[model samples]
Target: MSDQAQSTTMTPPAPSDFDGRRAFGRAARIRTPRTSHAVWSPPADRADPVSLLEEQATSRVPDLVPVRHGRMMVSPFTFYRGAALLMAADLATTPNSGLTVQLCGDAHLSNFGLFGSAERHLVFDINDFDETHPGPFEWDVKRLVASFEIAGRHRGFDDKDRRAIILAAGRAYRERMLAAAESTVLDAWYDHLDVDTMQAWLHDERQAERAAKRQVKTFDAVVAKALTKDSMQAFAKLVTTDGGQMRIIGDPPLIVPVEDLLDDTDIDDPEKAAREILASYRNTLFASARHPLSEYTYVHMARKVVGVGSVGTRAWIVLMRGRDELDPLFLQAKEAQASVLERFLEPCEYDNQGERVVRGQRLMQASSDIFLGWQRVRGEGRIERDFYVRQLHDWKGSLDAEKAVPRGTLLYAWICGETLARAHGRSGDRVEIAAYLGKSDAFEESIAAFAEAYADQNEADYQAFTAAVADGRLRAVHGL
Candidate 1:
C-alpha cells in the first residue's frame, strides 16, 4: 500500500453526540469550502491522459485494446466513460471535505440503471461497481455531475439548459442526503427507488400533453423491454444447439467459446476445465450443499468483451441448465482489478479485488443480485486472478441519455442524483454530509461550475486521445 493509503486507513473516532457530528461536518466547510470545488486547473506535472490509458492497456488483452479505444473514441462522453483513471488523478488535486463514503468510483450517468433486485422488482440504482472503493464523498458527486455536463454538450443543449440540469442533480443529492440524515437508521437502510416509483413520478410530474404522453410511453417501453432481458432471453439469443449438445455462439473479438480459445496443449480437456472453474465459483456463492446453484449443470463457457473501460479485461459468460435444456442460467464472471481510485485514495481492505467489488456493491446498493460472489482462478503459468460473478442479465437497462431531450435529461439527472445519494448515505455519515451541504445552493452551484470546467478538460483530453490514435501512439478499431 502507498503511504497515502496507510494514512487514510486510520480509524475515525466513534460517534458520541449527534450535534457534535453535525458540527464536525459544518467545520469541514472551513477546511474545504464548497466554492473551492469550482476550480479545475491542471497541474504542470500532471500525467498525460493518453499515457495513463496506455499504462492500463499493458495489463489487458492486446487484441481487444483497440476495441476499447474504439468505443472511447466515439465521443467525449464515451471517452469520459473510459477515463476514470484520468479523472481520479485530476480529482486527487482537488480540495475535499474529508467526508468519506463507499464511492461508486466511476459514478457517471450511464453507470446508474435499472436492474432486478433479489425480490424480482426492477429497482433504479448504481449498476456498476468495477471501480468502487472508499473515497471522499465529493469524488462521486463530481464524476456524476460532470457526466451530465459532458453528455449535455454532446446533445447540443444550450448553456442555460445544461446548467439547469446539473443543478437539478446536485440539489437532488443534497436534499436526499438531508432526508436520510433525519430518518431512523433502519428506515434509511431500507430506502430504495424502484422503476414503478419512477413511472409514477413521471405521471405526477409531467404536464398533460401530447409531448409528455409520448415521453412517458417511450419510458414505459424501455421498462417493458428490460423485463424481458433475463437468462431465458439470453438463452434464446446467444445459445444454440450444436449437434446433440448446447454451446455458446462464437463471435470472434466479442465472444469466443472456451474450446476455441484453448487448444489441447493449453488444457488437457476444455470441458473438464470449465466445469472445475464453475465448481470453484459455486463455492463462493453458497455454503449449503443443497443451494439452488447446485441444481444447475455447467454446459459451456465463453470469453466476452464487455463495457467501455472494461473491454480488454477477461470477462466470461458461463451457460448452465437446471433440470432440462430449456431451463437455462447464464452467469458472468468478470476479472476484478485494483480500483482506479486505489492509487489516489486508500487501498481496499479486502485482499481479493473481486471480494472488494462484491463487498462494496453489497454495501452501496439497497439490494443486489443473489449470485453476486467472488473467487480466485489460476491461469497458465499459475497466474492467479480475482473475478466476481453474477447473473449475466436480470432486467438490466439504462436510460438512453444520448437520445434524451433537455427536460428528460434533467429529470434523469435528478433520479441518478437521488439514487447516488442513497448509496452514499448507506455507508457514510449521513448527518455530517447533510450538515456540510446545509440549506444552500452554494454547494450545488459550485458543483455545476466545476462540472462545466471539467467538461472542458475532458474535451481537451479527448482531443489529445484522438491525436494519439491518429499518430499511431494508440490503435483504435472504430464501430465495435
Candidate 2:
C-alpha cells in the first residue's frame, strides 16, 4: 500500500481481480493440515554430506578450505551451523505448503539478533542473508525450528525440554501470522521489533523494583553495552596505536590483513581494490544511504574470517575515516554465492549474486542497513566473487546458544518464530498462508514432528562426517 493510494480516494479492486478471502479459501482447499505434516524420508541414494561439502569447496578459496572443515569438526551443532547447503539439498525433497516468500535461506537460531535500523533504533530480525532467495516460506521455518532441536541436543537438553522449545517456536509462528493476517497492510508495514520490546524481557523488573530501581538502571546499561559495539569499539579491539600510528593487528588464518594474505611479490594494492569495490557498492545504495558514505575515505582492508557456515569465503573488513580520528566507520564486505534454495526452485531473476542477497534482505526486513549494497571483485586468478557491504558492527549482538538455559532458549525460540512470521508476512500472501495454517496446533505439531525427525537425520549425518574425519578422507584443523 503506497502513501499515494492511501491519501487519495481510491476504488477497491474487483473481487475477481483481488480478494483476500477467496485467495485464502483457495489455498486452504489445496493444502490441508495433513499435507503440511510433511513426511521426512530420505531416498536410498541421498547425496553424501561430505561429497556435497567437497563439491562446494570447488568454488571457495582453496587455502582457507581446511579452516572451514576444522570449524565443522568441533561439534554436531557446529557441523549443522556450517551445512546450510547440505540441509537445503535434503529439504528439497520434503513436501511443502506451496507458500513462497523471500527466505533467509539460512534461518538458524544464531542468525536472529539485534542490530541498529536506519532509524537508529535497535531491532531484532534475521541478520544473515548470504543465501536468501524466493522460496517456500516453510523452508525458513523448517531451518529455524530444526536448528533449535539441534541446539537443544548440543546443550544436552532432554526430549521434553526440546519438544517444549520447538513447539513454542511453532506456535509463535502460527499466532503471529494469524495476527498479521488480521492486521491492515499499513499496520503490518509499520510493525517492527523495537528495543523497548526487548528491554521488557531483558530486565528483571521485580528485582529492580526491590533494589530501589538500581537494577532498573541496568536496563539502560544493557542497551548502552549493545550500542557501544560500533566501529570505535571494533577499532579499540582490532587496531593498535604503535609508535603514534594505528594499524590493524594480524592474526593468521582468522584475522590476517589483506597484505598478509597476498604473496610478497604480488603487484596489486589492496587499498586500490577496496576503493574500486566501494565505488561499485556506492552505486548500488539509494541516494539517502550513498550520500552519507561520500564523507568517508577508505583506510585499510583486512581479510576477516566469519561465521560457522561462512568460513573459507572471501570476507573482508574495510576501515574508513571521516571528520577526524574519532569518526571511524567499519564496513564488512562478505562473499555471496548462489542461493542454496536456488537449485531447488526457478532460476534467480538477478544477475549479480550479491544483489540477490541485498534484495532478499531488504524485502524480508522491516528496516535494513542504510549502507547495505553489493559489488563484485576479481581476485588473483581473475576469479570473480560477489559481496554485499554493511556496517560491520552497528549495535550487533548475537545470543550465545551455549549459554542459553532451557527456559531462555524457549523464550528466544518464541521470539525467533514471531520474527520469522513478520518477515514472511512482509514478502508473501499472509492472508492465504495464514488461512493454510488455520486455527489449530495440528500444523504446528506436525512441523515439530518433522523437526525431530530431521534432527535424527542430522545427527546420523554428523556421525558420517566424523567417520570421514577419523579415516583421514577430509582434513580437520581443530581449535581454530
Give the winner by TM-score.
1
- lDDT by residue for model 1 over 339-399, one digit each (tens)? 9999888768998999999999999999998888888876666677788999999998888
lDDT of 2 by residue, 209-314 (tens): 3233433344355567888899999988888766875567888778887778667213266778789888778989978454789999887778888987888887
- Candidate 1 local Cα displacement, residue 371, angstroms: 0.6
Decoy 2 TM-score against native:
0.90
Which segments of candidate 2 are over 4 A away from where they belong? 1-38, 201-224, 242-245, 264-267, 288-290
lDDT leader: 1
Worst 10 residues of 1 by lDDT: 1-10
lDDT accuracy of residue 290 in candidate 1:
58
> Model 2: which ten-residue window has the lowest total lDDT?
1-10
